[model samples]
Target: MRRLVARDERWPLREAFVIARGAKRQAHVVVVEITDGVHHAHGEAVPYARYGEDVPGVLAQIDALRPAIEAGADREALLRLAPPGAARNAIDCALWDLEAKQAGVRAWDLVGRPPPSPVKTCYTLSRAAPAAMAKAATANARRPMLKLKIAGADDLAAVEAVRAAAPRTRLIVDANESLSFEDLQRLAPELVRLDVQMLEQPLPVGEDAVLQGYESPIPLGADESLHTRADLEACAARYTCVNVKLDKAGGLTEALALAQDVRARGLDLMVGCMVGTSLAMAPAMMLTPGARFVDLDGPLLLARDREPGLSILGSMIEPPPAGLWG
Candidate 1:
């Protein structure tokens, strides 16, 4: 019989991670482990309040599914057993890790993908005043790319400050569903002129219809607005790109499928992550092969990461070793 274990953990951030939504000083994550007497594997996920999930609720959800999981429920079985959220994400990824260990092969082999390669990731600067943002941008100016978290007001000044501080660094901005249609319209032209490469989730989630016929100079990528394949059709009509995160898609199983659908629709792909540990970012690395932007900088923001984490060299993230999860 298989054994299942799930628990909540908190990892402190190097500094507060502020976004348009709010700020967090720690990442609250739920980790799941499955073992079949001889072999064991693990998975991790961050419970996002925006998705109506909290650590206690996620832990309870996982506990409720313990019976089925220990009885050998596979990844496909999990889709019907649990709704998409942080709970299913932890369980599904643990199953993948367990399967990879049992077979003595990498998880990519099971998914029929080539071995993952080191990918360049964007360093993120939290929402702050223009001067504060400029200071942070100056510190990371040598990074290949920097993603700025912006709120509607004073955002132009913040981006302009960042651009001036890091003239050679590529820039992308995320509004975290905090912007209105008018805010996007007013900011798009200036962002383009500042050489900003992309703008993510400017409008609120359900209100994405506001972008139906509108065209902007900078490409808009859907983050909070797009989750799994079910959300693709509506988002494709409104946005030029999609951000795929394992926790948002439920797990790697669904994220891989969503990545393909994003490409099939001719929308650019960006694999992103919540502010968790490297364990949470490891599985997401699988989706970065052809992605236009990779934002799996979860560990970089942490004060300390789980040992045996993915190797990050400067702005590049190396693939996770089997010991870490696959």
Candidate 2:
């Protein structure tokens, strides 16, 4: 029988993490580990309040699944038993880790894929006032690219401010489903003039149908707009790119499958993250090869991260450490 272990961690953020939903003080993550007699593996996921998950609830669910997991539950079967949330994400990742360890190969390799190379990633400048956002962008001007998070009407000011602050750096604006059609229309010209590379999830998930046949100054990416493969067909006509997060997709099994399907459908890939530790970001690196942009800077937002973190060189993400998962 396999053994399962799990725990919750509260990693304090270096600064308040603000978004359309709200602000976050800590990145509350739950990590799961699975071990057979000879090998062991681990996975991490954030318990998001927006998703109706809490630490206690996730732990209880994992406890209930222990017997089934030890009795030989494959990832597909595990999904059937647990709904898509942090609990399942943790367990799914741990199983992938265990399999990779047992096979003496990286998870991606054992899963039948090549390793991802170093990729240029976007360093995020969280939502702030126009002046502060400009200052933050100026401070990070050395980064090859930057992703600016905007919340509401001040978005134009925020984007313009960041643009002026980092004139040469490539820019991507993520409204996090906060903007309206009116806002996008008004800002398109400015975004184009500013040379913004992409606009990510300008509207809420269900409201994205409004973007159908819409002409955007830049390609629009799906963040909350797309989750699983089931969402792909519906989003095809509405979006040019898909942002994949291991947590939202329920870890590597589904994330890899989704990435493959995304490429097959001629959609650009963007590997992103919730505020998390390197353990979470490490597994996500496997999905970065075909990514148009990577935002695995979760570790950078944390006051402190778990040991042996990924190297963030300016805006480039380096390879994961050996034994940090695939």
**What are the lDDT scores of the predictions, listed in order?**
0.93, 0.85
lDDT of 1: 0.93
Error of 2 at 109 (Å): 1.7
lDDT of 1 by residue, 1-326 (tens): 99999998989999999998889999999999899999889999999999999999999999999999998899999999998889999999999999999998999999788899999999999999999999999999999999999988458999999999999999999999888888888889999999999999999988889898898789999999988999999999998999999999999999998999888888999999999999999999899988999999999999999999989988999999999996
User: How do the predictions measure up, each by TM-score?
Assistant: 0.99, 0.95
Give the clash total for candidate 1: 0
Clashes (N, CA, C under 3 Å) per candidate: 0, 0
Model 2: residues >4 Å from true position, as ranges?
A: none
List residue ranges in candidate 1 displaced over 4 A.
none
> How much is the lDDT of residue 197 in candidate 2?
93
